[model samples]
Target: MPLPHRVSDLSAFDLLLSVAELGSIGAAARAHAITQPTASARLSGLERGLGIALLDRTARGSRLTRDGALVADWARTAVGAAAALDVGITSLRRTRESRVPVAASLTVAEYLLPHWLAALRPSAEGASVALTTGNSDDVAAAVLAGEARLGFVEGPDVPAGLTAATVGRDTLTVIVRPGHRWARRRSGITADELAATALVSRERGSGTRRALERALRRGTDRPLEEPLLELSSTTAIKAAVAEGVGPAVLSSLAVAAELAAGTLIRVPVVALDLTRELRVVHPAGQALTGTPRTLAAIARRSASLDDPAG
Candidate 1:
């Protein structure tokens, strides 16, 4: 059925609800950010259009009449339903845009991407994201192959044929279980001592592993020792460390909760730089536009919220 011609104005209904809530036309006008005179004129027009007295006005204030109270109750539901319909339309538009394909390294995929996506929704951006998770190299490959339109990674360098914007930084922390020997050390361990030891590690291509190797190489000419155990996922590595598997160097992003809860101990490493850039990457010549661009800006702005200092 068609909406009634007499009550077709949704804004007027919204204003009516506001007046009902605030108890005065002037207060409602302030809430809606309009002039009191404009508010009074609009409400008057509404009553005239509906052929009913919706307000009982006196010198002190305006209050809803008996008929006005009933109309206000119905208007509340109408306004709520209209708002829900608008949200549904925005969601449909997002679907029609097709989820913006994103490739992200495990750290970003697990820890940061959801927050970025959350920031997008309330703004009515009419876009959505479909995420693919992997190591930094895998993320780069996905973007280059057209499998993803945008990619996020943390590492010493952006891969060839891609350009990156630094959105944040990740500090690789050397962590061990609370009972481990390094946990009680009064002095920081040297890079040589770290490189010579076998510890649990991320698989070779992971940004976490690469950042550690790059930092260790600066202080030694010898190749780094093999991992005691190699894990593909950050969560698994954290679990292994907490179980006293061995020491592992991981992104601060990955081990924050464990450190906070005393489940893991952060062993200081002297004279080593374990910090790496967290970046958003795309094809070399292609500039980000639309949703991806906006998301990247949000990432840059929100960078400092969770990261541990280097």
Candidate 2:
């Protein structure tokens, strides 16, 4: 089977999708590093080629017409497939070279690292990546032991032997099922209440667990109690919480979709700050160079884009 000639122009599809997302052809041009005239010409060319009016141009901005909206939806699918192909090709190239080995904590690996990797891929030249997933402790150990060129961790305290640069921020949220008692509480849970409750939790070495323990220990002498169930993975904890096993603390990134869907309700923790810095780590005294440096830059850029204030 052969594809249509118009479908072969992936860059045009990507540009169209970007325009749809950004809401203006000029904005999309700037984002794609092209001049407004160039974007306008390209879009006009695409419209003429397809024999359809794609955009309703206005003085304020441009918007997709009904037909354009349908085409943009299809363009989004094509762009996503192209991105997957790009990543796959990069991974294959990595296997043949001395790829930069990266170790990252589970939250970061699952939610943020993929975007960073994608941002780095096109400009990476011949560079490739090998990623390892672990807890904060494991990531730090991998970087310090020289097993990984770079590492990402979610904990507040950086390990002794690693130099860390704050790359992003993740807020740990307290969540419970719809029917849980905490979900119906009018007042936020106090620090003491959170500490004493035997809820589902991560393992001891996890960054999420560490952040919770630190918050619980503040302004009180009460020792943290053991969790009702200690799980090593965030997925397991989320599942348990949704099943009404117990309320659990998890990264906001991990539970965003569930929260939006109303499957998980956020229970505010009064007098406790659960926010944690996400950091990129490398062995102390080792200057970041080559692929690691590029990766760090991409991570920071990705973080800035996610930050509303940035």
What stretches of model 1 exceed 4 Å from their correct place? Answer: 1-96, 305-310
TM-score of each model, in listed order: 0.67, 0.66
Residue-pair clashes per prediction, in order, are: 0, 0
Model 2: CA > 4 A from native: 1-98, 304-310
Candidate 2: clashing pairs of residues: none
Please write out the lDDT profile of model 2 over residues 1-310, one tens digit for every residue: 7888877787876788778889999999999999999999999889988899999999988988999999989888778988999999988866644478999999999988899888888777777788999999999989888889989998878978889999877788898999998899868788888888898999988998988788777745777778999999999999999999999998888888889899999988887877778999998899888678988998887784232211
The worst-scoring run of ten residues by lDDT in candidate 2 lies at: 301-310
lDDT of 1 by residue, 1-310 (tens): 9988887898898998998888899999999999999999999999999889999998888999999999999989999999999999998866746578889999898888888888877653556788899999999999999898889997667878898999887788899999999999959798888999899999978888888898899977767899999999888999999999999998888888889899999998888877788899999999887787788888999877344633
Candidate 1 lands at a TM-score of 0.67
How far is each candidate from the true structure, as Cα RMSD in Å? 12.5, 20.3
lDDT of 2: 0.86
Per-residue error for 116 in candidate 2, Å, reads: 0.2
